[model samples]
Every structure is written in structure tokens, then in C-alpha cells.
Target: MKEYKISLPICENDIDTLQAGDYVYLTGTVYTARDAAHLRMYEAAGRGEDLPFDIKGSVIYYLGPSPAREGQVIGSAGPTTSGRMDKYTPTLLDMGLKAMIGKGRRSPEVIESMKKNGAVYFAAVGGAGALLSKCIKSAEVIAYDDLGTEAIRKLYVEDLPVITVIDREGNNLYDSV
Candidate 1:
């Protein structure tokens, strides 16, 4: 498997180097946002309200994990179904999101948006809770604390394994798989 290590707000060089099926070990800061957070973000965008965080080149991980165990940075943090975020994805992409990390297939509209905006979709292993959680070195909630697991969090990770599911060129590994 081909491997890459990148920081967030990934640039064109990072996106261009990746292709469908490439394995990635993302480091640096990534913001976590799920269905609730996505909804709030879309709503804010509709109301002309500034987002809680900048969306440019941001990688949003779709997850709602169990509380971290003692002495652990995070708990059972794995990708939730990507479909849940489909409705909100295009809007975010239009708003300048460059990368999204989740699992499973995304809708055609989302795929189209990725192609149109030079964005990429990545897939983490499904149900690999224990394995996935170990990659997170630090975790702290940055927004929507009341939403619990659905809240936005800033995660500092190292070698977080993922596969390129959809490339900016509109290649989808899922269909070929």
C-alpha cells in the first residue's frame, strides 16, 4: 500500500499526490464533526453566520464515539456511516472543504461535488474501534459540547490509517472494489 503523511488544510500538492486506493496516515490537527454538527454548520451558513471553524482544506471526520476510558485519549473512535452526512456534504464542499474522512459510500451529489471542487473522500476501516482509537494522541472538544459525541472536537493524531475512497478526479475505489 502506498503511504502518505499530511497535516490538515491539505494543499493541492497533498491532494494531487493521492489517488484512489492510496493509503494515508494523517497527522496533525483534524476537526471532528458529525450529523448534528453538520446540520448546525449548514444552518449557520444559511443564516450568513460564520462557521465555528474554517472549512478551507479542512478534513471532517464523521464519528460519534463512546467516552474515552481512563488514561486514554479517546474511545472506540471509528467512522460512522458516511451516508448520514450526504445531505450536508455538498454545501460544505461549496464552502471550501477539501477533504472528508469517513466510511462507506457517499451519494452521487457528494461525489460530483468532490470532483467539482477538487476535494477527496477517505475511508477508515469500519468497526476497527480499538485499532482506530490508538492513533489518536490527543482529543479535546472544541464546539457544541452539549451534543456529546456529536460535538466538534480537535483531534491530534499520528499515523491515522485511511484509504482514498474518492479522488478529486471522480475516481471511486468502492465501485472498482
Candidate 2:
């Protein structure tokens, strides 16, 4: 495995450089959305409506952060189970999403879409919300506030840790294990 430090708004050129099992420390803006937010975005796509955020070169974290404690930018922000978003992921990839940060495995179709679109899948350490939250510099709800913690949020991070679980070539870390 290898390690890399990447900046967000990650592009096709960035995607081309990663391989499964490589460690990544991401710095910049990334968005957070869980199942509910994803479904809303997918439905918006179906309606030919614009999404809340631009799709191209964006990295999304599958998370529903808890309320922040006093004087904190965010709460225990960590990865959610990725499979929960599996049904909607490929569509986002097809729409130009460049990378995803979450925990666990993705479905075959999602992997295929990642390859076809030159996207990447990453795994943040599960159960490490507090540690992960330290990397996040700011957080704001961008959509679906009624969903509370499940609302879509834009986060600015510096050196957020992750491991590439699936590369653009369809290589899967779980398959190797």
C-alpha cells in the first residue's frame, strides 16, 4: 500500500493517481450526506432539477454528524455504513462525483461505475468520530435541515485521514482480504 496527501475538489487527474489500499489525507472542502439526503438528491436528478451542490470533482462523506459540543465547529463526525447508500451511489458517480469517504464495502455496480467514471472509494476509520471531527475546520447545513443530523453539510477539512478501498480501475481492498 501507499500513502498520499490530496486536496479536495479532486479532479480526474487526481483520481487517476490513487490505488486501492493507499492511505490518503484529504484537505479542503467536502460535503456530508447520508441516506435521506442522497435519496433527495437522486430524486432531484430524476426530475432533471439541479442538485444543491455541483457534482463535478466533488468528494462526499457518508455521514450524519451529531450536534457539536460547546465551542466546536462540529460534533462527532465520522463515516456511516456505506452499503446504506449503495443504491444511490452509482448514479452520483455517473453524475461526476469524484470520490466518496465512508466505511465498509460497496456493491458491484458501484465499483463498476467508479471505474467507468474514474472515481474512487475511501474508508475512514469507523468509530473514530471524535478524532475525525478534529480535522474538520467548519461545518454548515446546506440542505435538508429538517432531517436534522441527516442534513447535507459542507465541511472544510485539513488532513482528514482515509484509506482508498476502491480505485478507478475497479480494484477493491476487501476483495484482496
Candidate 3:
């Protein structure tokens, strides 16, 4: 597998260079959203309303971090199970979402949409929340404050590690294992 360091707002060119199982360290803006946030965005789109943030070229992490301790930028910022968002993923992909960071296999429909939309999927190691939080340099809730930890947060990450579990060409690392 190859290793790459990528910046956020990844474009089609960046997606083209990635392959399943590649190691990547992402440094840039990443939005955190869990299933609750996804559902809100999906509903907003259906109503022809604007999403809270620009969806184009965005990388979303399916995370809902806990309350931070004193002096911390964020709490345990781990990825949640991805399957719960399967029903809403295809729509987001078509809306210009570039990549997603989460754990677990995605549904076949989500995989197909990724191929059609030229998106990538990254997997963060689960149960490594404490370590991952160190990569987040800043965090601010940008929407859905009522959801508390599940609120959509704009995070600036530095060298956050992830594995390319599914590439734009539809290669799936899970299938290889």
C-alpha cells in the first residue's frame, strides 16, 4: 500500500491518486457529523434548502466527540460506526462530498455511489479516540447545538491518520481481507 499526505477540500485529482489500503495523513478542515447530523442535512436537501456548510469537496468524519477536559481542543474524537448513515450517504456523495472517515463496511449502494461520484472512504482505527483527539487542533460547533456532542463541528486537523478503505474506483479493502 502507498502512503500519502493530503490536504482537505480534496479534489478529483486527489481522489484519482488514492487506492484502497493506502495510508493517509490528512491535514486541513474536516467536518464532524454523526447519523443525526446526516439526517438533518438530507432532509434540508430534500426541501431545497441550504445545508449548514458547503458540501463541495468536503471531508466528513462520522464523529460525535465527548466534552473536553480543561485546556483540551476536543474530547475523545473517534469515528462512530458507519453503517448507520448508509441510507443517507448516497445523497451526500451526489451532493459533492469528497470523502468520509469512519469505521465499518458501507452498504453496497453507498459503494456504488462513491464510484459514480468519485469519492473515497477512509477508516480510522476504532477505540483510539483519545489518541485521535490529539490531532485535532481546533473545534467549534457550527450547527445543531441541541444535539450536543452530535452537533456539527468544524475541526482543523493536523496529520490525522486514516486508511483508504474504499477508493474512487470502487476497490474495497474489506473485500481483500
Candidate 4:
């Protein structure tokens, strides 16, 4: 598997280099933004409010992790199903987001947006909690703290293994594999 470790605000070059089945060992900052947070973002957009975080080239991880164990940065963090965020994704992509990190299939609209916008979707292993959690070096909630585990968090990670699910060219790993 081809490996890449990129900083946030991942550029078009980062998206272009990824293909279905490539492995990514993400480092630097990544944000956790699941269903609730996504809904709020869209709602804010509809109301003409500015988004809390920059959407450009931001990688959103679909997760609602359990509270971290004492002395640990996270607890058993792993990818949730990607389908739940399908509705919000295309809108975010249009806002300049470059990549998404989750698991399982996404809607066709999301895939099309990824292709047109030069974005990519990554799939982390589902149910591999212990393995996945090991990659997180630190984490802190950046927004929506009252949403508890669903809050958006900035995470520092290393070698956080993921498989490319959708490429910029519209290829899907699920269909090909």
C-alpha cells in the first residue's frame, strides 16, 4: 500500500496522489465531526452563519468515541459507518473540504462531488478499536463540547492506517474489490 503523511488543509496534490486501496498514515491535525456536528454545520450554513472551522482540505473523521481512559488521549477510537454523513458531505465538499475519513459506502452524490472537487474518502478499519486508538497521540474537543462524544475534536495522530475508498477520479474500492 502506498503511504502518505500529510498536514491538514490537504492540498489538491494530496487528493490527486491517492487512489482506491492506497494506505494512509495520517499525522498532524485531523478533526472528528460526526452526524450531529455535520447537521449543525449545514444548519448554520442555511442561516448564513460562518462555519467554525475552515472547510478547505479538511479531513473529517466519522466517529463518536468513548471517553478517554485516564492518561490516554482517546479511547478505542474507530471509524463509524460513512453512510450517515452522506447528506452533509457534498455541501462540505463544495465548501472546499478535500478529504473525508470514515468507513463503508457513501451516497452517489458524495462520490460525484469527490470526483468533481478533487477530494478523497478514506476508510479506517471498523471494530478495530484497540488498534485504531493506538494511533491517536492526543485529542481535544474543538467545538460542540456539549455534544459529548459527538463533539468535533482536533486529534494528533501517527500512522493512522486507512484505505482509500473513493478516489478523485470516482473509483470506489468497494466496487473494485
The candidate scoring highest on TM-score is 3
Q: Cα deviation of 95 in candidate 2 (Å)?
A: 0.9
| 1-177: candidate 2 lDDT, tens digit per residue | 788999888867778999999999999999999999999999999899999999888999999988998999999998999999999988898899999999998999899898898899999999999999999999999889999999989999999999999999999999999
Per-residue CA lDDT of model 4 for 1-177, tens digit only, reads 677776656777877888888887777678899999999998987898877787776788898998887888898899999899999889899988888889899899999988888899999999997889899888989889999999999888887888888899998989976
Candidate 3 ranges beyond 4 A from true positions: none
> Residue 117 lDDT in model 4?
86
Relative to the true structure, how large is the alpha-carbon lDDT of every model? 0.90, 0.93, 0.95, 0.86
TM-score of every model versus the real structure: 0.96, 0.98, 0.99, 0.95
Ranking by lDDT: 3, 2, 1, 4
Off by over 4 Å in 2: none
Q: Please report the TM-score between candidate 3 and the true structure.
A: 0.99
Of the pair 3 and 4, which is ahead by TM-score? 3
In model 3, residue pairs whose N, Cα or C atoms come closer than 3 Å (at least 3 residues apart or on different chains), thus clashing, are: none
Candidate 3 per-residue lDDT over residues 1-177, each given as its tens digit: 899999888878889999999999999999999989999999999999999999989999999998999999999998999999999999999999999999999999999999999999999999999999999999999999999998999999999999999999999999999
Off by over 4 Å in 1: none
TM-score of 1: 0.96
Q: Which 10-residue window in model 3 sums to the lowest lDDT?
A: 5-14
